[model samples]
Target: MLIDVAIEKVKGLISFFEGYRETGFLEALQIAKEIALEMNIDATFRKRRKIKRKKQFDENPDDTNIAPQSAQESFRVNYFIRVVDQAISSLTRRFEQYEGYQKIFGFLFTSETLRSLDKDSLKSSCVNLEASLTKDKQSDIDANELFVELKSLQNFMPKENIGPVEILNFLKRHDCFPNASIAYRVLLTIPVTVALAERSFSKLKLLKSYMRTTMTQQRLNDLATIALESEVLEKIDYEDIIEDFISKNTARMRMFK
Candidate 1:
């Protein structure tokens, strides 16, 4: 997906989540309560029924004070709020990281973003990217080389605005601009959302249990990839897989036959 589309999607999800948490959840909870009442079950949370004692003069009142809250209100505050807040926090962190990527690769992401940059700003962005990619005296692309390549590229760009995918395509067809091509390829690799990655992690938790702590990194990665991409696995013909396996394992194939 395009960066702009990804940004919009992230914003939309955040807004929808916040709206649901603020109002929609409570509305749904009220319906649930009604249903519970109809079934003759307790709708509200169990009371704490705390036994209070007189405070000593040595203790500060603020240290021991607990605000009296209704059972339902207490449940919402202690349980629901904490759960939703964790989700919101994770979203906020991912959004912030995405924004940082946009800042570094923003100009290269689209023709509009690229065109808006002047010579100096464009050079500055390239330098920032070069620094980010640099580690232990190694770098992916030279900032000076990239800036020069982009300037040449701008002259050949079409009147219609285009995104990184199109720019990569053009570079591939021409087979020129080595630095610019590298930059675009790296930009395209950035994830639009963390959903798929996080989902894989959830699968990974189940696959790599405490009992299986001895799994190698490569093996674990392979297992996780297979688990997450099960739909692709389902689409494959079993006959073709059997044939591939047979070809690879000649001794086993002869024994089976």
Candidate 2:
């Protein structure tokens, strides 16, 4: 159920972005802020309810584990309230850092404005993009020329075709605008959740059971990696792997012969 809620929240964020793709960054930011506000309100309500229930639970000493109904209700309320609090905290942190994201990816997200941006606006965006880059990456390209190339590409490309992937493909195809491509690549690599890490820990528990308590960390990591990527591993040809193994080792070849 928590996963479902998380998925729904992601979906909401995607939908919000999609709807505001052609609009400017300000519009998108407003939508996001509204969504976050709604979530905050819901979280505040849940927190208050949790506090009231906790107070009730504390006030009646006899009610503490005396009745399964009261105890179960308390546990359920506490666990759910914790989940809500976590979700709220995550959203709040994202909101706090939103301005930086807007500065970096704002132009990429606003497809409609890309082609129409005048020299001053494009220059400002270029400065913002360069400011966001690391010192090593910052020195490697001319932001002004990259902005010129971006404007030229935007002139030829349809507004609808202007997106992160489309722009990336355009840059790669033309071998132009290295800085812009790198910025987009950085944006693409940013993770939205810790679900993958959580899954890894879960896999670790399964692989390193009580009986396997003495397993080395290196061996456990290898096993967990294999387990996590089993879908990809399943597609590999084990027969080919065995043949290659035999070809690489004289002992294996002799044994097989």
Candidate 3:
């Protein structure tokens, strides 16, 4: 059910995180909760099981290591919840801190460096450091709009954080070509999260569509390779290579001369 819910809400979930980095933890947890709900995993079930186990332990406290087992289980459950909650909280705080620093200084640092400095760095750096990092000083362009656009990016994504087109449009809205260009530059670095590449490869697996029956695994691999490398096959006698293999195997009854 959670997977179904996730599938249905995938678009919305992505959009939220796209605009706001802080939404990452929340989205991850939401997805996890949705999955757990779908799988019918509940606190009630865990609690009931815990109670039953506790009774068994109470009846034979001397014989079994029930205390340690219970402690470990409780620790595991609490650890899971804490880890999820901490991640969400950290994301929110980190994004805000980054935004604050950028607003005052104009540059976003790498996480390592960002973690080192305090508010002192903000005063020392220019107000447009982040926006100007991507700009040519000779251009003498207004940097305010770029900062405005950056700040407007929120944690709540409408659906699918943002698409290429929407991000392009967001850049256009700010009229900060330098920042927009940089955004696109960063965008290209991210691999497409969609499974289009995998699906295309899957099509290669079905290359034996010409045959009706199930193909032998080896034959399937050969067919897939041939189909994928069809252009290269045009320049080589691939069939002859396989025929040679058959000849080598079939005509191998040699006697000592």
Candidate 4:
């Protein structure tokens, strides 16, 4: 989708340049400058209007002095644009952390990198990983050892079967290349979204309402974990749990026997 938008933007720019060329340089410059100035003025007006509308809404949130639907529609469009802009800005900021990780992962999984397994390419991957971990001050691994392990692993594993899990398993099986394995593990642990955290919060709310206000943190965590992994829980045999429960109590064990 981003590619499509970029293509269209490029096409628009081409058309713009062609039109300007046909109209002569000086005329085109004047026209372009005027358009830019007008756009800047319009943007300023829109910003002011948005602020004014927000202030009005804050003053009277009850919809008592609601504007006409046509006016409201314009406000909605402005509101939507503001929201989208803010959301994109927030997402871009969050993605900055993963940008280095992305480059490292790309290098790790690439056919060329795997086939070559040279010191230079491996060093570049290490640099990319280190940049991603800028918050941490120390680089713990031996670079030469990591390179050797990567080359050995690449030779052992087929290109067709290479993936995140496969690479992790290969590292585990060999029990070498602690640094490279740690990097892969860290990459695997990175959350793709906040949805899981949000879901846990939602579950907490449901589990520890006013009735259950005295629940301990440990118990709440246990319950929440169970709630989240309900699919796994569903597969368990309740009869086995019952037997285990009975065995834990001597009286119940005697009764069952």
Estimated TM-score for each candidate: 0.67, 0.48, 0.22, 0.51
Most accurate candidate by TM-score: 1
Which ten-residue region of model 1 has the weakest summed lDDT?
2-11
Q: lDDT per model, in order?
A: 0.85, 0.65, 0.47, 0.63
lDDT of 4 at 41: 46
Residue pairs with backbone atoms closer than 3 Å in model 1 (clashes):
none
Q: What would the per-residue lDDT of candidate 4 be over residues 101-154, giving only the tens digit for each residue?
A: 456565564334466757677777766666566556666455556666676766
**Of candidates 3 and 1, the better by lDDT:** 1
lDDT over C-alpha atoms for residue 50 of model 2 = 26
Please give the range of 10 consecutive residues that has the lowest summed lDDT in model 4.
42-51
Q: After superposition, how far is residue 31 of candidate 3 from its true place, in Å?
A: 15
RMSD of each: 6.4, 14.0, 18.5, 14.3
Tell me model 1's lDDT, rounded to 2 decimals. Answer: 0.85
Off by over 4 Å in 2: 1-86, 136-141, 197-257
Q: Put down candidate 2 lDDT per residue, 123-233, tens digits, no spaces.
A: 888777776674955454457876877777677666574556666776777675777677667655554467777998889889999999899989988999899999999
What are the runs in model 4 whose C-alpha is more than 4 Å off? Answer: 1-80, 109-117, 127-144, 206-221, 237-257
